[model samples]
Target: MAPLIAVAHGSRDPRSARVVTAAVAAIRARRPDLDVRVCFLDLNAPSVDQVIDAVATEGHSTAVVVPLLLGSAFHARVDLPGVLAAARARHPQLAIVQSNVLGHDHRLVDAVRDRIVAIGVAADDTRTGVVLAAVGSSDLRANDRTRALAAVLAGDTRWAETTVCFVTSTEPNVGQAISLLRSRGVERIVIAPWFLAPGRLTDRLEAAALQAAPDVVFSETIGAHPLVADVALDRYDTAVVAAARTRLSA
Candidate 1:
């Protein structure tokens, strides 16, 4: 059977790798026979090259490279493709399919919503406000994704307001966002992290929240949620189906 490789934007934080591994494990539960593996783009073991090389060495002709990113940013657009190109050159006969980043999936939205609910926000509390925080990317299109995600969550009646915030690379960092929410007369604010795991940026975001708006609460990082696993699987399936169609067309 073909192998499925889940690729993450690696970090120095071991928790990041652990979370990605857990998500891969959940996906494996749905496909017992097929080989499922987790690899990183950088800063961790089993880099994309290593994983693809192992797959090729094991005699797998086809492998799906699924990126565990929230949006199409530099890593998704440039870094991943570069890695895949190099890997393909090393093994010219290997068939590789690149998947899309996880962008605006309902499961991911639900996971964020769940985190908001977990932080003592009531379903009917109109006074409650939310700040969806993310690691800012230099890519404008990628940064827009945070706003898009906030809009989706704001539509729910439970959340009176949802604002997008970033830790870097964009305007209205978490601190500014929290102050803005408070200034709008919101009684309570919950800063929801749009990250896969707790990293240095997340730590800074939480610290800034405490300093800027001591009254506001911050939710836990959205790490290894089962819903995320589901979204990853959906992206993988979509990529595989698209690849199959392309082959037939050729």
Candidate 2:
């Protein structure tokens, strides 16, 4: 089996790395025989380059790099590619196939729904307004994708209203979203973080929401959910098949 390298966007908060570790562990639990490793793109140990070098030293000629990201923002488009290019150059014998970022997948939406339910919101609760919160990006398309996911989540969960908000680099910040919900006469509102792990941004979003509405409910980051593990494995399998096809074509 090809080694599965799960790369995450690191954070200064220690809990962030721990959450990622748990997520990788979930993947390992599902595929116990598979070799799984966790690395970070920044602010954490075992960087992507280090992980790639270790896999190469372990004598694996091919490996799969799975990006633990929700959207194709700056990290996915620019940082991960540059890191992979450097890794390929360093380990010439290793064939590292990069997998797609975990974009607006239904499983992810399910994970969000699960988080909402964990916070005591019923699936068919029409009185509670839901706010999908994310670490915003300069890429308009990335923001658009988040909005689309918010719509899907609202429809699937049958919430009364769903709105998109950002923690940075975008409008309708968490505070603004909560205000909008409150203005619409929503007495109970839940902010579902569109993040894989708990970090500074999640904390910031929660703080902002509390300031806006002291009674607002904030859900946990979608960490180590079974559905997320399934998505990680799916990306790994898809990358492996794609790599084999490329090899045969060559």
Candidate 3:
């Protein structure tokens, strides 16, 4: 079987890396027979190229690179592909296939929903407003996709309204979102992160939310959630199957 390499956008925070490790461990635990490894794109060790080189050195003919990103931004679109393409050139014997990002699947809604409820906010509380937060991107479309998640999360319950805010971008921000919910006569506010792991970025967002509304509740990120691991493995399996089909056609 080909080794599955889970790639995450590395963060300076140690908690983020630990969560990535635990997430892949969940994947390995679910499919113990398969070889699962974790790597980072930047700001961390065992980078994507390092893992790719290791796979080639280990004599694996084929490998799958599953990006653990929630958005199809520059890192997912340009960064990882560039690394994989360069790796392919360096090792012609290795056939590398990149999997889809870990987003757009409905299962993630369940994962975020779990985070929301864990913060002591009732799912059906109409007076409670939700702020679905994410790391902003330069790609406008990617940010739009993140904004859509707010609606999906709102559908899960009757929470007053769910609005999306960014940690590092212009226009809509955490403070604005919190104020919007408050304007709607929502006294109870919950800020749910659309993040895979807790990092400095998440901390920044929480700080902004606190500044806007001191009583706001910020839930933990979707770190190492079993459903997140499930999504990564599903993407890996999907890519493997697609690669096999392409070979069959060839």
Candidate 4:
């Protein structure tokens, strides 16, 4: 089997890289026969280019590149592809196949709920209010998809209310979202991060939420959840098939 390079949007926080590294490790555990590796886009070690070069150097003729991103934003659409194109130019013998991103997979929603549950926030608790927090983007539509997740969680239970707020680059920030939940008489609020890993943005969200309402608590981030690893592996499997077809046609 060709190597599976799981690429993450790197962060200066070592925790972010650790989470990704561990998650890819889990993928390896699940499929010991598969060659799974982790790399970063920036601010972390073993960057995408480095990994691609290593894969080519390792004598792999073709490899699958699975994006460990939650949103199909600029990094997914532009940055990664640009790097892959360069890698192809540098190694004409190696075929690099980029897989689909780990976008709002419904299983990920389950992972968020799992995090909330881990924090002792019952899914059916009516007094509880949930703020689905994410690192917002400048693209409004990207923000909208994240914002819409609030309802998907609310619909799952009788929680007082569910609302979304951005940690940056958008309206209804952490404080505003808490106030909106407060207006609805939700005294117990929990900020459930929709992120795969915690970083500076998550710290900012926590500080702001506490400032708005000190009583509010936060669930753990969606890091290394078995479901996330499952989704990534699924994306890799899909890309493998797609890549094979492309090669046959070419």
RMSD of each: 1.5, 1.1, 1.2, 1.1
Model 3 RMSD vs true structure = 1.2
Number of clashing pairs, model 2? 0
Q: What TM-score goes with each of the models?
A: 0.94, 0.97, 0.96, 0.97
TM-score of 2: 0.97
The 10-residue segment with the lowest total lDDT in model 1: 152-161
Q: Rate the local accuracy (lDDT) of all candidates.
A: 0.84, 0.90, 0.89, 0.90
TM-score of 1: 0.94
Identify the runs in model 2 with alpha carbons over 4 angstroms from their true place.
none
In the predicted model 4, the residue pairs found to clash are: none
Candidate 3 C-alpha lDDT tens digits along 80-145? 999999999999999999999997677887788888888787778888888888888887887877
Give lDDT tens digits, candidate 2, residues 162-211: 89899995998988888888889877899999999988888888888888
Positional deviation of residue 209's Cα in model 1 after best superposition, in angstroms? 1.3
Give the per-residue lDDT digits (tens) of candidate 1, residues 20-121.
788788888877886889999999998899999999998888999888888787888899999899889999889998988876686787888887778778
Model 4 C-alpha lDDT per residue in residues 1-250, reported as the tens digit of each score? 8899999999999999988888888889888999998999999989999999999998999899999999998999999999999999999999899999999888888889888889888778999999999888888898889877877767668788888898886888999999998888897999999899999999999999888999999988888889988999999999999988887999
Runs of candidate 1 exceeding 4 Å displacement: none
